[model samples]
Target: MTAPTPAAGAPDRAAPPGRPDGTERARGIRGVQPVAPLLGVLALGVCLVTSLDVVTAAVALGIEVALLPLLRIPPRTLLLRTSPVLVAVPLTAISIALYGRPSGRHWFDLGPAHVTDGSLTLALATALRVLAVGLPAVVLFIRVDPTDLADGLAQLLRLPARFVLGALAAVRMMTLLGEDWRQLGMARRARGVADTGRLRRGATMAFALLVLALRRATTLAVAMESRGFGAPGRRTWARTARFAGPEWAMVGVLVGIGVVSISVAVCAGTWRA
Candidate 1:
């Protein structure tokens, strides 16, 4: 094999001169990228408070307070664009409220679990905690282009390259599936099969899409294996994570959130046995 010469002024060009490998080029992600400090703080709040750590929860909420200004994201745009996150945030709250451990003085006695002022208060706290924790994570996910995330995870966290990059490729395929799903829905409607009969046909189509998605996932996994995506050798990261001061700042933010969440819960008299 002959060593390929770089194309005129294009240092990273893979093939004959000006041509570059698709993976070699940097891809732009959607939304404003967050500094590592912010994400660190928010994610830490979620992880730390998960163990009912009041200090951690309080710190997480504090970061959220600080982030309201830091994020510069418009409210209308935030609500409309981040609709998925909005849905997720509350759903998470409901889950926590329903599943959280019941404690405190009993206010109303029910058949099984009594609904007490303490329980209501606990539920609200849990719900708030979930809402606070989930929104940032979801927002961050929205802003993070999967490619950048994959690169960052692999290079910064020293994640397994095969797993990280393979997942990134899979993320790209979802765009195709999104279109495929719309077309499938339209085709069913065109065939007069979309009306509400014994349950909506659209629901059936949606189920079919689920199966198709699972099938596609399995197929993609196999295809990746065949295409040397998993060939066991040293892999070089095309993009590197530049850990500036911001990254370390993110770590501190997480620690701060963890401490605060623990403290707040304890002070609020919401800590359970």
Candidate 2:
């Protein structure tokens, strides 16, 4: 009996030729990814444990930021300078204060609610924990080129290609959103229906952007169907994705963070007891 031939069109399994990051900025970004796996790991841990022992997570973040040069991601594009994360930081804090744990001593009772020192402490811990976890994911992913990340995730974690491939395609098309936005703005101005007041203008701009996005999305769907992107066949990778030194280093960093953070929490508990 003849062995069944491997399915046609599977992506190549061999590691591809490597390229070096020559830009100082890219170097810094690349450096961060090694630590990013760690930061992201610790952040996930803190979220699960919800404890104040975030020294490990903080340390992981610090290392990742310091090594940011190695990730080869641009600071501006990588969410290093994004406003959303900054906004999230404070919002996390507020959430803790409003809905955090109830405490032993009630400072005040506002009918069905009591505010206490314990709740305050819990809120603080919760806020810190959230930021510690979320920041790294955002940082790592923002700077990460979608294609590279999809490649890494697929090869290292063995994720199904369909989803990752779809995400990659989506990201590749995101660039067009900006151009569409510009055109939509021009069109709105031409129609004389655009808002002039600051409050209305901002809202109008958001609505306009959303409409432009929806239209592009429709166009993209039609384009994909026409191009046979969804056809069943072996796909080829233009760039080789490998989980070598960088990936291992990242995992090691994460494990190290888990050890350190949990250890500190244990020590602190013992001290209190």
**Candidate that scores best on lDDT:** 1
Q: Estimate each model's TM-score.
A: 0.65, 0.66
Question: In candidate 2, what are the lDDT values of residues 1-273, reduced to their tens digit?
Answer: 997765789764554344444332322135433334634465456433644534544554455566567656666776545467667767876656555677677777666555777667666555555555565556555545555667666655667777777787778878877786677778878988665776786677778788877887788778877876567877666655555576666666656654565566566562111
Candidate 2 structure, TM-score to reference: 0.66
Q: lDDT values of the candidates?
A: 0.62, 0.60
Model 2: residues with Cα > 4 Å off, grouped in runs: 1-28, 31-43, 46-82, 188-215, 222-228, 270-273
Give the residue spans of candidate 1 off by over 4 A: 1-43, 46-63, 80-104, 188-200, 203-227, 260-273
lDDT of 2: 0.60
How many clashing pairs per prediction, in order? 20, 25
Estimate candidate 1's RMSD in Å: 6.8
